[model samples]
Target: MEEVEVVVAHRDCATLRVGAVFLKIDSDQSRTEVEVRAMALAPIPTPEIRWREPPVLALAALPGRALGRLGHPETASSAAWVAAGATIRKLHDAPLPPFPERSRADLAAEVDGECAWLLANDVLPAEVVTRNRELADPALRPWTPVFIHGDLQVSHIFVADDEVTGVIDWTEAARGDAHYDIATLTLGHQTRLDDVLTGYGPGLDPDVIRAWWSLRCLRGIRWLIEHGFDPSLPGGEIDILKSRM
Candidate 1:
């Protein structure tokens, strides 16, 4: 066996170290990665900024050969959609006994603060800011909150041989409405969600799904306004939000 050396050491709230592997890694490590929660900084109303801890999951690096050389495929098969839904269900069912309790109002306040900062920094257009406020104004009803992987997207997911092997990046994980997670997935996949839910099995209400879809659109709009429009975000996403306004 050869010794591996660290080639990159990147640190933010959580630390990530990439190294050269000397030999073949096992499947278990690839299947089940380590999850670490780290404390991150968030500005508050006070003169001083506060530290808030967010969950961060560590993922094993994929082998060079296994890496996808092309962008996300435009179409996913029905089976692939089902597989993605199952992966999300497993994540939603994960235990988080020590997670902090937060209300919908609390989340709205957080979003408001973020929007304010973005506007102050001239990151978003005035129209976008106004639209965000309108969408965030609706009082969110109290529902059974679950452990949501705040930023669930295709780029953060690891798939091999058409199976979702690992879900990565938990920096945004929190106890919130399940609709948030559903929305995140929908925004990333767009029109393909119908296929996903088809594989998502029965029992989900059509009304609830529609609600989740609306919330997802709102969240994506907020993200784009705050972070500036990234070329990578789906064109349909921007169009949907504009249409909603």
Candidate 2:
């Protein structure tokens, strides 16, 4: 048996320090194959992403490699999209605890702190933040939470032979509206949405999906404004948000 090699240690989402490894395994053909491993090294005593308590799991390892860079766009067959959607549906269907008693205003206030930092740093234009606050819909937000893969872009989705082999990065996974997960994917990678929706099955409401999409856009914009020219932010995303605005 071979051991996994730790390759890198870095911080993710400004909260968790991630230690990534490369595991060597023997293939059916008696060849060596390398698999990636990721685990959370430490918890941010003061997490900026949200005001949740400590995470349940201390570490998690994904089964496959991240696809290229984060948020890179890729064209997929409708069949592929359906597969991704089905994957999401399975994740959403899983059991999760209910959301905490925080009001929508409370959530907004938490996010406002991050926005304030971005504004102080000049990472985001004041106009953009004001517009986002004005457009926020408290009622549209989910009161009861479902399982959400906090970050669900193409990079977090792993593929093998044109199929989604696994979903990675459960560190940010939490109880939220199902649409939060769906919206994250659609707004971050709209090109593959048709397939995602197709795989999500027939019971989903288009209106709900649209609403989530808009919310996802807002979320992405906030991140970009905070991070300022991050490699993770896609060019198409800026274009999409600009068009909408």
Per-model CA lDDT versus the true structure: 0.49, 0.50
Candidate 2 lDDT by residue in tens digits, 136-236? 44326655565566667666666544566666554455566666666666665555566778888765555565555544554555555455545224544
Best by lDDT: 2
Off by over 4 Å in 1: 1-34, 37-59, 62-75, 115-139, 202-240
| Runs off by more than 4 Å, candidate 2 | 1-9, 12-71, 97-103, 115-121, 138-140, 203-240
What is the per-residue lDDT of model 1 for residues 173-206, given as tens digits with 9 covering 90 to 100? 6666665565556553556567656655553444
Q: Could you estimate the TM-score for every candidate?
A: 0.59, 0.60
Instruction: Give the TM-score (vs. native) of candidate 2.
Output: 0.60
Q: After superposition, how far is residue 26 of candidate 1 from its true place, in Å?
A: 25
